[model samples]
Target: MKKFIALVSVFAAVLLVGCAPEVGSDKWCENMKNKEKGDWTANEVRDFAKHCVFK
Candidate 1:
């Protein structure tokens, strides 16, 4: 049971990490561009401008 739990935890972590591009990365910028503007959080909008646009 412990082994199975550990495997599931690891799988969840991997899936979470793989679900989004790293912040400020080119891929992240592209993803933001494609994503719905209405769905973006305030912080995401700020970071997108700070890192993706200004940089």
Candidate 2:
């Protein structure tokens, strides 16, 4: 049971980390551009503009 729980935890961590590009990276900027504008949080907008646009 403990081994199964550890395996599930590791899988969950990988899924979360693998799904999104690192924030403020070029890949993240491109991802933000493609995602719906309404879905973005205020901080994402700020970071995207700061890192992706102005840079």
Q: Write the per-residue lDDT of candidate 2 for residues 1-55, one digit (tens) a residue.
A: 9999999999999999999888889889889999999999999999998999888
TM-score attained by model 2: 0.67
Model 2: runs farther than 4 Å from truth? 1-14
For model 1, state the Cα shift of residue 45 in Å.
Answer: 0.3
Q: After superposition, how far is residue 44 of candidate 1 from its true place, in Å?
A: 0.3
Model 1, 2-52: lDDT tens digits are 999999999999999998888999999999999999999999999999999
Best by lDDT: 1
The whole-model lDDT of each prediction reads: 0.96, 0.92
| Candidate 1 collision pairs | none
